[model samples]
Target chain A: MGHVIRTRTRASTVAAIVGAIVVLGLALLPLVAGRGLIQDMFFILTMLVLAQFWNLLAGYGGLVSIGQQAFVGLGAYAMFAGVILAGIDPVWAIPLGGLAAVIVAVPTAFFAFRLAGAYFAIATWVIAEVVRLSVAQWKTLGGGTGTSLPRTATRDIAGTGWIEAALDVRGAAARDILAYWLALGLALLAIGAIYGLLRSRRGLALASIRDNEEAARSVGVDAARLKWSVFLAAAFGTGIAGGLIFMQIARISPDAAFSVTEWTAFVIFIVVIGGIGTIEGPILGVLVFFALQKLLADFGAWYLIALGVIGIAVMLFAPRGLWGLISHRTGLELFPIRRRLITTKGNDHG
Target chain B: MSILSLAGVSKSYGSLKVTDDVTFDLPEGQALGIIGPNGAGKSTLFNLITGNVLPDAGRIAFDGRDVTRTPPMRRCLAGIGRSFQIPQPFDRLTVFENLLVAATHGRGQGEAAVVRDCADILERCELSARANDPAGGLSLLGRKRLELARAMATRPRLLLLDEIAGGLTEGECTALIRTIRDVHAQGVTIIWIEHVLHALNSVVERLLVLDFGRVIGIGEPGEIMASQEVREIYLGIEI
Candidate 1:
């Protein structure tokens, strides 16, 4: 029994060390990369956030909602409203967008939770469309033509003497590098939060519901409540990603803000490529996906088609996903939510 | 005093009556066996008790409190734990994680205690070896063990086992029966729905034979098995 405890302690210590190293490495990347690379990194980080959100919803909660773009658009628009209308700082707008998404998610979850399986998926899609159409008809937020953050405001912020003063020693590349670091920090925080949530009790309930709704209910899991919590969380996460995407591009349009095809498709691909239901899978999947995108940038539309093909292939061959297959072989999980017993010679009481 | 009482419980789908005026009382810590052939509403009865299905017409009381309309989770929190006929472990979760969920959320246990109880339950179910393995990869016997482990994790005063021994081999069934006996010995009231007569006979003292949603016989297991009406409806040819 002592030997077993010792072994488990040693294993957990090693896992903790590895996790810390990985996080620290990610945290420091912005200090090393160039301006263009930093911007690209920011985009990747945003993608990672979306992937994690989708994974939590479909992968863990068994809520395969295609309408997550509703919140994505809502978040972008929230940023627009915050900065341009409400006069809130653009950076602070991200969390506001997340909060707005949560507010919307409650009613959406109420309506969507009534349906199950395919019907639930469809209801979410319909909800997204309703939001999209409503926003599209609103003449004030650049209904169809799209909206752009005022260039004057961008120039005013960029011209801040403090940024220039700081970059004087490191050159213009330093400012862009700082932005990259900010994006990377956000991504890491999002991933870490998800990791923590998944290791909590609520995560277990979500997993049970995902596996078998009826059985989960029989065991006293309130499937509706759990689903609602996950829905709001997912919406909050996706909305933050949208806010970050807009910050990187310095613009937001109704079509672009709500573009399900771009953000949702990319997120779905990342989570699918990585193992769904595992915290680290989406991060690894995002890294691989970004690598492929960079390598095949010249392929244009073919790049998207290739991505689709790769997603299909991954699903067919490794339904558990690439990270899932690797984890199966290595038996290494950075976020170890489950326990295992190691029996010793004298531990035969069980 | 009875911990649970169901009176005039009836459930129907369109024209078919799944539970027909089924009534029973479960005194605290009493083991009740529900035996019936296929489609005899044995599992449905358990569901009604746990509030999985609201009766079309009936009243249910738990600890003398009217809970006829209480949700499943509330019932579970009130100390009712049930296993599915087909063992449905959270496929993406490890065996230990699966039980930990029931312990924490279903029973509202603290995290450390939940972990301790989960480990103990896993050990008792002989699943300690495969505790870290994903639930989907388990064998039929392993799944059955997990099903029971999860239910026990809830720390229920009343447990409903729905054909947990159905798909297990004879050896596996015996092992399961022993584990269940140990649990029952701990004073956890059990209502088991089993087609496996031997397994039921070994564990339960009283048997309620159900057919077409009504109790055909209610007595000691051997006496109920030997009843003429129960033989005609459930036993049919032999045993």
Candidate 2:
């Protein structure tokens, strides 16, 4: 039989074309956008990166980790240690931060694996707190008091001089632009990687496991192996995002780096509101989150309360999130991970 | 040649014995029917064979290889596929995708084989029209067919069907029986656990009956059904 497996629909085919153009447009946006806008984009892109990783873990892998902030903090602190103690350039230190998170994640994954569901979420949060406490004792990176990147390191960061000359801007503007480009690039890589995994057999396996673990196992799915791989991969991506986040600010401390509200809560909110499993959801989720923040930031306490109210409303009215609702109405999947069966019955299975 | 043998297989939940030294042999490519009242442990036997539950004692050999310690998936990969009493389709996945998982992971087939196998199995089960529908949205009959279709996609040598006829309309049951007969005709072994006597009677030549986890009778279906002991214990016929 001549049969084909497909994920793309007619809408997704068109979306792919438009999406590529949008990416190209986004790349060129830095050329014309002002400094503040680039900075804002940096925040949104990094949050999207973190949200996508979370989506992969909880949305597809069936892992609901509440302590992803642990990786974020670990990554940020690692960047500080690399720059301050190891005398590494701030730019190169970003990858070091991610490496640090991976090192910590290996041991944490084993511990977290023991618990499941709600317990797993709690265990991750507790471990994150422990990580933050452990890092707090290290005086070399300013200990409990926290510290900033040295002036010399910040003044001559990797790609800073080149970006300044190329973009024809001030030193501060060059720094922002450099961070902006890096954020854009990493966000694209994150989305691409998630899409790639979801398209492969691995994605099918994860989907199987998430639907029903026992049923998945009965069908020869190595549920444990698939889950562990997803957990670790998400941790690595989150670590990279975390490092980038703090590197943009050029400051780090256990409390600031590991703040649950800043790193984990906001990321969870984005994924939850956007649509947990699909690649398009987080993009929409982040924009909505930013829009809400901008409108409500002046309200302070009202802003936080309003977020809670809206989150509840969404959960009740549309449990699948905004993207899920949109997909149901429009049937447009930008990153199609679902397989379609194309059958040529004339060629029978002999 | 015997394709499977369960010798002195036993299992218990606390003090309740679900399977007490249950033993049987199934010949290659022969369709066998198992009948029992509620709680007679027909499902437990299926679990033992499929590796969903480990037998407390004795050996389970498949094609002359001891597989007592093999995990459930390995048992499936080793050519033992089964359907749940209640259909367990991967609900979020499309019916086609559900079959694709079996053809790929369970059968270890490549892309071309998977695509062909899934399509063939879907058509065989009369699910070609509903292939694009999400499994969760399928009607009961469709879900049941999807279950059988998914099991067949694994290309199993021995298929264990647990109550495949339960909750089906007479027409649906007849359709399923026809499909099961066709599967049997292809020389694939079948071990069906069902309460629906007529459905079982249509497909299997050999019938095995259980009561309280012990074999009550085993023979040709007509011989066993007409026996005095079966009439007294199972049929409870006064005439």
Candidate 3:
């Protein structure tokens, strides 16, 4: 007889199967769905990617940063710079944006790491503002007014022609299909990478750091190093999502690129209302967010007020978020990371 | 050879000296008990040794290497493990997960490599029943056991326990002492800060007494307890 430690649950295995089928179905949607639905999905998928990255930083790493707009703005701006200035295709330029975001995140973390709690959150916002202002001074990218990706660049993006030919769609519809597929891929990568990270040894260290930094250090977990890594990773993922979003919109202005309300606030709200710490939280949160927007967008300020009310109510009643409430009741984990010890007889694998 | 040595160590917060020119040495594999009145810098001494707090002026050598400026994490990795005076378990983590964190990082091993050892540590600490529960929901005794279990999981050559025996029932204290004895018998050096005199006496080979941030006496357990200064300061008995 022996004991085996495993992190998998029956529910997780089933969830994995269901998730794969759902992703496959969504991947095939662009083949049959109208352009309007495709564009809507592109929006949801990109936002989901952004929300997951934010959740990893704030929810898992215990970093509540409101300055994620810095990465989004920098990434989008960098992509624009690559296409407009350097003649790189917008698709290839997206990775350049991610790289640029990582480059900026190092210094941002160096400064923001000095602050704690709410101070840290505010410092990240301030840094984002500074980045936004500095990017606005670059006249080549239209400075404060911003610039559009040249029609030539978007019309002939690397995979747009391939998608157009394969899906039997016009060039405009092909571009939308291309962007939608890219958004879907990015969402999958973001969630997959974060899920992998949260199950590794570093994930355990991160959880400990989130619980108590001093105790974590006493236990030999290097909280500072882990935090730096998480911050940079979030910045990289956010930057790519930003680049992808701007590629779809084909426009870039500092204000539009770095809008805290659109990028940071909405992402935070999704993670908070969906569930902050769990992977399932942001996935569920983005859907709720999209539904609320579709239902209430015509009400203008009332929409914002409704969101605020719902946010406050969730924080008060279900503090862990909606998914948290559900998971607490059902004991189901789609992406389970908690290890359980099971006793097994000899030659019987667990 | 001494496993730990503190020479002329002093720490002051503002004008008040918390550790005033203290010096001590403990040979390898010896269990040394520390007793002191409130505010006598007992926990402060443990902090200084564990690298949680740096001294104003002194050298601290562990295993013949100077570690005065090493950070707490590095010190833990260097085989100096400690339990907090207050139980500080990672509240959201399960008890077994808590041990996994300590074992993996403290030993610089991967989870797959340390999971078995973590389970053994859990069973030895008698926390097997609560292994899957969140540490925050644990009772006081369970938390204390977790504190001890976590430090032990670090695979330390030296363990520093701070008032871990306090706030437990007599039976609980006896059971804890038995666990400590089992650990001590395995030859891990121990520096225990305990107010439970009988518990301290039963395990420690030597006793050191502190009063007002100064070492009042150090000797065998019986000799230190018999000393007039120790009796007056620690026992509060008229000499």
Tell me the tens digit of each residue's lDDT in model 1 across A209-263.
8788877876667788877778888899888777767755777777788777877
Prediction 1 TM-score vs. true: 0.91
Global CA lDDT of candidate 2, please? Answer: 0.88
- Pairing residues by index, what is the TM-score of model 3? 0.98
Interface RMSD of candidate 2, in Å, is 1.5
List TM-scores for all candidates, in order: 0.91, 0.96, 0.98
Over 4 Å off, model 2 = A345-350, B235-239
TM-score of chain B of 1: 0.96
Clashing pairs in 1: none
What are the RMSDs of all candidates, in order?
3.2, 2.1, 1.6
Per-candidate DockQ values are: 0.55, 0.63, 0.68
Error of 1 at A94 (Å): 2.7
Docking class of 1: medium
**Tens-digit lDDT string for candidate 3 (A1-350):** 55677899999999999999999999999878999999999999999999999999998789999999999999999999999999999999999989999999999999999999999999999999999999999999999999999988887999888888898899889988999999999999999999999898999999998888898999899988999999999999999999999999998899999999999999999999999898999999999999999999999999999999999999999999999999989988999998776656763343
| Higher-ranked by lDDT: 1 or 2 | 2
How large an RMSD does model 2 have?
2.1
